[model samples]
Target chain A: MKAIKVQALSKKYGEKEAIKGIDFMVEDGEIFGFLGPNGAGKTSTINMLIGLLKSTSGTIEILGRNLETQKEAIQAEIGVVPDESNLYPEMSGIDNLTFCGSLYGMRKHDREKRALELLKIFQLEDVKHKAFKAYSRGMKRKLTIAAAMMHQPKILFLDEPTSGIDVASARQIRKMIEDLHQKGTTIFLTTHYLEEAERLCQRIAFIVDGKIVKTGSVETLKASLHDQSGLLLKLDQNMANLKQSLQEELKLTKVEEINERSLKIVWPPDQELTPLFTFFRQKEVHILEAKRMEPTMEEVFVAITGIEHSEEKGGES
Target chain B: MNKGIALLSILNKDIRNYYLKPPNISWGMIFPLAWTLMFVLRSETEVDLIEILPGVMALSILFGTTSMLAVTITFEKKQKSFERLMLAPVSLYSLMLAKTGGAIIFGILNAMVPLLLGIALTGLRAINWPVLMGAIILIAVTSTFLGLMIAVAAKEVFEAQTFSNFFRFPMIFLCGLFIPIQELPALIQPISYVLPLTYGVDLLKVAVGAEGILSVFLNFTLLLVFSFGLFRYSIHRMERNWMN
Candidate 1:
């Protein structure tokens, strides 16, 4: 059996659905990315997988064990790093990790050794004796992941692991994630940063409004955009407005913000770019450069989630 | 790998992080001391130290454990630290035990403050040591579990304390803390019997050689029952809260 097998899982909060009957699987020893915009049920799905939230309907199987019935058994072999740092703030970094190790039933000697090892592995050894609350934001995030890794679980679930941290720390964490993946831990990663998923995930699932609209290898998603191609629109100044305008005005499936001053617009090979150029000129936006490019994962995400149909389109100003 | 270690781990962490914090330590010490001073000052003549000893000790355990446990649990939840514990491999019962263990210890310690004070004031008398120990443990257990239930009932710390006071203040009046249950207005006497703390103080009364209104065996049995009932209910509410 796969490491994670979520089948038709759903979660309801009163009258609203947070996770709508979504299904996916994480192959053993591969990084599986669950990608979505905010409020797309990513956290809900992770909560269910980790046994914090029960599914209203459907099944979740972790390593062939039913999540509902075998939660403790499954929990014994799985570790999770939530978006926020949940370790005890007043405790030192080492204490927090050892405490986590103990929760997984690690012996005191072994818990201590593993906590020390993890503190070093996550580059938290320098602050190992420092109170968690005293550590910098990046250091705190690292300690949290170290705590999760203390038990040496077979699978690791990281939810927005790099969100709200400094760039250098995010880079370090991403590298650590790759190292963990290389060491044969099946990783279930949820992230909004498509670039990170493109770089790390072996297979990705795109969830929108609680439903998964796409699930396949990065290559499979790219393959679907065969007839389509991306047009990179590099501007003189940052214009988040340009991406929104393009998506709304053209009703295009893929117009993404590549960075502050650039957008990638995807369309069929036969579609004319002249109209977009005309629209840019009319909006008094200077195009620094425009180049043809292969369709990126952003295109696949937009194509899959069908963001073009998203309502309340910003009045095309 | 035993669950025993995990229980100890959580208890130790809670003691270090919440109960042993200087603010909490000060608060725990002040409650019993302040109560001792208040009643002492209120006496027009000589203070009857023995008469108020059991009441002060019971009140200390009740307020200290309930306030401290409710605040710690709610704070952990708000900070998402409790959510981390909930994800641990331990069974729910073990987890709950670990969570309340710190408060139980604190409750017993709070009772000790008044006991020592009483001893220092009146000179240690013919106190039944074993019965006093048992009563202290029972009261601590019952109060901690009651606090757990109140914490489970509310979302935020303030709400937990408000809900906690709803039960705690009534117990002070009805649980024979300041007044004998029989001397209270007849209409409120039944409320006294229903309170877990009342049974606890009754046991304390007998332990201290003061005549107890209820049978000693019945008081012990009722306190146990109340502790178990509150514990089970807290777990139920916890699971319910955890899901959504």
Candidate 2:
């Protein structure tokens, strides 16, 4: 069953259409990456799904209940971690989590036990008694995530869950997300880190300028770029003569010299790497490191959106 | 049933964070105590001191509710914590009610310090228990609603402080905090009638035996109307602005 279904969801802020009519579905228990450039309406759409913002028009069904008609039911089953850390700074971490748990009607003892367990998982046990003002950015982020998960929600919407954290912390967060996914929690995550998305998400949708340009499994998207291929070759001697011969003899698309003895080539996948090896052998040149380069999520993203993903840095939705 | 539990949980958190802390609780007590001391020292005549005691109590409620609501709300807005609350299952009205209810409780507690101190130091006479309780409830509700109105109108902390002061100062001074409305100029007395604080202080003074309880009831009823009206307006405005 689909855990979340959004159809023709739209939101406008004044004259600017924040989320142009868009549609998508998140399957139950799958880590679905809502991939998009900054300011691509990812947060706006998530906010609407959570009932935090009213959509200009559209329908959203969460856990098989219409969001507009069954907000309470849907909200009871879902949890949201907004991009910003919205916990009360004057309160202790434990206090924030317990308050969130109480909203879901958990008993005090049950809430406290659950909160303590979550704090331990997030490595915030030591800081549970301290006020939020003293917490670091990473600690705050972790606490926010813990708060969102206090009720053991069925669907979790995590917006940039590991942003601005250290590498170790990001890895820990990724491990935690994987653990949640293993336990059958459906996660709808929005993040700038394509590597994280590539590592975790079963399927990703690349949104550009309020429109979903592409959506599929990572392997499928990579296969879409099957026609594009690159070759890295190493030579024992200078390749100036060989480079010129290849440029003239073959329909080389792009050739760049890495060093005096190495070269990189880009061409259609249909082109024979064996021919390149034979050409190198015919010139009495040594061949080293000759293989096809697999496409990175970054490359796939660029190919789909026609804009480099790095260009959207520091832009928030 | 769950809604009641959630509301209680939120209310409990508000009280602990806003009322139980040493700094906040001490500040709440000190303001009213300071005003009580001033009134005791300035009351040259025995009757005049009795009159000033009720005004001081009213002032305490004003200061407690307005500053607490403004400062705390500004902090919440800056931290974006209110948005998190809005995302919860509780309705917006329930959230606002919890906040306003919490502020009223704090205001009542703040008002008590000066009234107790005035009775102790001045040996004030004939305190009508029912009238005084009614007056305290009146003042706390009106002050909190007014504070919420000001907080909702402000976009930033500085703006809230400035806007709160613009009305709070005049209401404190002109609404019989330091002087009786009858002793003020005729035009100013009419203005005082329009101010919620004026009605509040009038009722408090009547409770303290400076005026008639019947007159106080009339003023108290008007204050109730204003408080409810402002509370409704502020809640509506807040929902419009923050709930999206």
The whole-model lDDT of each prediction reads: 0.86, 0.84
Give per-residue CA lDDT, model 1, range A1-317, as digits (tens). 69999899999998999889988888999999987766778888888899998789999999999988989999989999998889888788888888899888889899999988888777878888988999999898888888888888899999888877899999999999999999999999987667888999999988889999888898888888876787788998878756677788887877778899988877666788788878888888889998888777776777777664233122110
Q: Taking the tens digit of each residue's C-alpha lDDT, what string does model 2 give over A24-61?
A: 99999999999887778788888889988888888999
Give candidate 1 regions above 4 Å deviation. A231-292, A308-317, B37-47
True-structure lDDT of candidate 1: 0.86
Q: TM-score each candidate.
A: 0.87, 0.89
Candidates, DockQ: 0.60, 0.52
What TM-scores does chain A show, candidate by candidate in order? 0.80, 0.91
Identify the candidate with maximal lDDT. Answer: 1
For candidate 2, the per-residue lDDT at B92 reads 67
